[model samples]
Target: MKMADEGRRGEEDGGPGAVHQVFVVMESLLEKLKVLNYEEEILAKHNMKNLSRHYFVSSPFLAVNPGEQFFLFTVIAAWLINEAGRPFTAPQEHDEPNATVSNILSELRAFGVKVDFPPSKLKSGQESSPNYPAETTEEESVIEDDAELTLSKVEEEMIEEPDDEEENVMDLEALKLRTCPTDTEASSKPEEILEATVDAAEWSLEVERVLPQLKVTVRTDNKSYLDRLQEDVGKTLEKAKERYQQASGGVTERTRVLAEISEELEKVKQEMEEKGSSMSDGAPVVKIKQSLTKLKQEIIQMDVRIGVVEHTLLQAKLKEKSNMTRDMNATNLPEPATGPFA
Candidate 1:
């Protein structure tokens, strides 16, 4: 019984969340590709397999199976390298006939890979080879060792970890024994843990199911495809520039309109000031008329205010009457010691 419980616990807690992570990686890839205007021909030939091939072949340290979804990150990394207009660093042997140097380059950029170039060389357009081949150095050797050490530590932790005590305290007559509090708690933990484990299992199953259906969505390798995207981008930039010019011209026109409005407002203000000065010369009837207009507005506002106050008062009276009626009707009932028992 203890062994069964321990097995269940191991299955639950030991599960990895790789499915969700893969989905995230796939979704990110689509998002990055959304804005890119790929030529139809180029898009026709593009597949995840070939893309992975391009990636793993380039990076010496990385080896990925072309058919698997798990290598999406690596493919993205490769795509980033190409997009930034860098030379294809993947070994020449892995290069396919259809894979243009730019496809690999553009994919890397699409994935938002940052390649550090010397500013001085960049300004001069002078390309320099990396001192280390594909991100390896002597310190990385030590880091690798450290990684192995950490992994060994984790394995040791996994092996030596103490089992939950309730698992060992199983009733011999499992069917006859009542559900104990400790057993209930232990059972509850397994349900929650099992949920997570089941989710991973379900996701893996889904990936397995869907992977075969993912008919290698071919991507464009044609030079015209990149050219087309570049042309589209150029046209877009031109349109943006034209729109900016038109917007700038519109802003100038708006500024002129605003200035005219300002001048008109000033004229109106000056005219009003002149009329005020004339009125100040003891025009009693004009002042009386203005006072009468203000008085009429005040009277209107007061009427509205009075209406609101009367309505509120009526509502309050109605509520009071209803409450009183309820109180009167509530008599001859059992009275609790507490006041206002409902």
Candidate 2:
């Protein structure tokens, strides 16, 4: 949610510093991609360069799949910085925010890491009720401690002056007055309750304002990552399918070729045997043996190659079958404002 606002401001401002920062991010990403023999085919498919300018300026990543979008964001962030003519810099270090339960949950969602942050036990409809602040038993305990401190102070003051009987009696009455509710006090209870209710209503309105906007942020973030993954993996899956088919069909053809080679070897062996008994020199037989040996080795090598291809083909299919569900699940935020902090 916090990053969402920064992103918008970066686009609108588009100052030299902002552009430079973005170009640096994109350039850094491209460098990493180069190391991995990565190609920006996703950009080419969209008929656009995966530059930080257009991407940060707009949501072009959404048009692609998750991996592609992720590549664009993570890698392009560095490139944008470079393009803006800024010197390369590493991500700056800073202390993280206080580790509140809410902040932790939000970070998990942002990073697309799943961790269950279970909510505290609450009365039905209590969470949805706005007039009451979302607090746990711990908060109530804190308030109860303040109440006890107030009572202790009153008791000490009473103890400090009790030599005069009338004064002591008056003090007792005052203490009772402080402890017990009179008619006015009882009547004012409704006003206090009303004020509390109004406060809760305001809190509800605040949550309403923040939560939906956060929802939009989360959805867009998830969609961009997903789009890139789908595009990259989806393309690989398709290519794998084609390779699998070709490899599968080629296996039969290769086996037939091997059989033909075997038949030729047998014929050569027979000819060598028939000619061996009458041959003055063994050169013909030796030549036949060498050729047969080479042919047999070639068949063995062919089998190994086929086996490798089959394995590759199997892996591709499994990867293709793997859906984006688990990958996407990490971004699924716990029901808004319902975790421990909420």
Best by TM-score: 1
Candidate 1 TM-score versus the reference: 0.23
Span of ten consecutive residues with least summed lDDT in model 1 = 1-10
What local lDDT does model 1 show for residue 301?
100
lDDT of model 1 at residue 339?
57
Judge candidate 1 at residue 122 and give its lDDT: 18
Query: What would the TM-scores of all predictions be?
Result: 0.23, 0.22
lDDT of the candidates, in the order given: 0.44, 0.45
Q: lDDT tens digits, residues 1-342, model 1?
A: 000012233345675553233234333334334323222312443442223223322222455343332223323324334433344444232333123222432333333434343222211212221211112211222333444555566556556664643443433344223311124554666444334344664455345434434445455578989899999999999999999999999999999999999999999999999999987777788788999999999999999999999999999999999999999888857756865863
| Global lDDT of model 1 | 0.44
> Which regions in candidate 1 have their CA more than 4 angstroms from the true location?
1-219, 283-342
